[model samples]
Target: MEKALVYINYPELIPLNDKSTEYDGYITIDDKFTYRIKLQVPNFPDVKNITYSGGRFHYIAIQEEDKLFKLAYYDIPKISSELLKEYASLNELFTTYCNCIEELQTYFDVMDSIDTVCWVIDPPKPKKSDYMRRIMIGHNVSIQITFDPLNILNLPQIQFMGSENGVAPFRESFINNLDNWDPEYDVVQNILRLIDLPFFPQEPTDAAKSNDLDFKVNECCICFCVQLENKLPDEICKNPNCEQCFHTDCLYQWLSAVGTSRQNFNLIQGECPNCKTCISCRIPNI
Candidate 1:
């Protein structure tokens, strides 16, 4: 029955063996790209029995593949355990898979373009799912930009990281020139125009100086480590006099244990560990 359905609906897919449980084919998207895929259906017409036997889709390796898979599983429709599913369900699965591939392609293309114009400080080698990047914009200054993978041409969310005095002018320039951003320009060009900078600062060539800068920029106050769980310290104390930095997870854990800390919706209000000034740490939804 499955063999018949494949022949009727997907003539391009060819059976791998006599059992007809496995098939391999090239799935074309928008008449522009063809992806070689292998699908396995152990039980005919059972949506739960299908699996992706291919190693990596388009050689794109995302750090959040497990999260993406869970989302897809819950979002995709499922049939009752006792009933056989229609071919439409299988079609939906293929459609969702193709959409993911297309999104990843766009994400990598943008990342490659950004790499040429800026030195990415965090996540030195970005994965397909790592949409947020920290790049050097000036001496002792950096900016974190988060891109929407699906909307590659849109203006990204930006946050400046460094001394308040050092980033103030850049922040003001960015706000004043927000309307000047053009989708026709690439990501690097738009950022340059927004900050009114001719070019991003080049990375330091002196090994000793670069190491010293990295230590000061990435160390967490609580953990006293440069990296924890493949992430640098991103949370900062808001108090101008006590601008201590910490990992978000580390701060959350510390705040949860503190007697004076209070939870307010998604934010944990507490005193800074260094200077004891009032501060808040945003709880990550993930």
Candidate 2:
């Protein structure tokens, strides 16, 4: 009869079984923020018996949950001391839980905005408390942004990745437009404004895929392979007419076998395999 009354008053919470010891529901605050929650209440009146089984807890970092739980269970002295009559009601406990979750509104807001706009490359999926993300911004280009969880509306620390030539323009634009960043906008919006892009690049289309397959410019002339040991043929012959490509290791080994090859510090001065033109290979650091 008591469990039936509690369900009638708090329709948001649904019991898992006839015993009504477990519940699955959501807590909505001010009709704006809602978080899914699961609760196990073996001893209803004893707050300690109420165990949080799942929901937004998974969205947040494990380390930060302790503080939230403490806030929910112990922040109110009367509730913790068992002196308040309202503590006997599950509604009162859920209200306190909702208040604690409200404090994390900014974190949830920022994460939702990021998910809507960015293609997160690293950590593929992010927690509500994850402050860093690497997102694809352009073709073969990405930018790593470390957000300030407290000041999410402000500019984040950003590092651009890809070839030097590819990322230089974006880097330059970001530096020049730093003052133009508007804190009123979301993180992704501010970043797009700074880089002057309408939106982040999506995955390549079928036409782009076909174009990429049309060339084997990255293939190694020595090993006759496109990639070996996860490395492309990065070493190229200086001769414009005989611009053959070789992996750094392959070139170094070939040059070392020739008696004419001379080692000067970390450089191997050698002849091109095709043109016999003077070329050099920088001995890659092991």
**Candidate 2, residues 82-199: lDDT per residue as tens digits?**
2222334444545555554454457557776777667665545665546777777764456778876656677889987543455678999998999988888766778987887898
Native-structure RMSD, model 2: 11.5
lDDT of 1: 0.66
lDDT per residue as tens, model 1, 120-200:
878777754577889878644679998877677899999997656667899999999999989888778899999989987
> Candidate 2: deviation at residue 139, Å?
3.1
Worst 10 residues of 1 by lDDT: 61-70
| TM-score of each candidate structure, all chains considered together | 0.63, 0.49
**TM-score between model 2 and native:** 0.49
Model 2 / residue 18 / CA error / Å? 3.9
lDDT of the candidates, in the order given: 0.66, 0.62
Question: Which pairs of residues have clashing backbones in candidate 1?
Answer: none
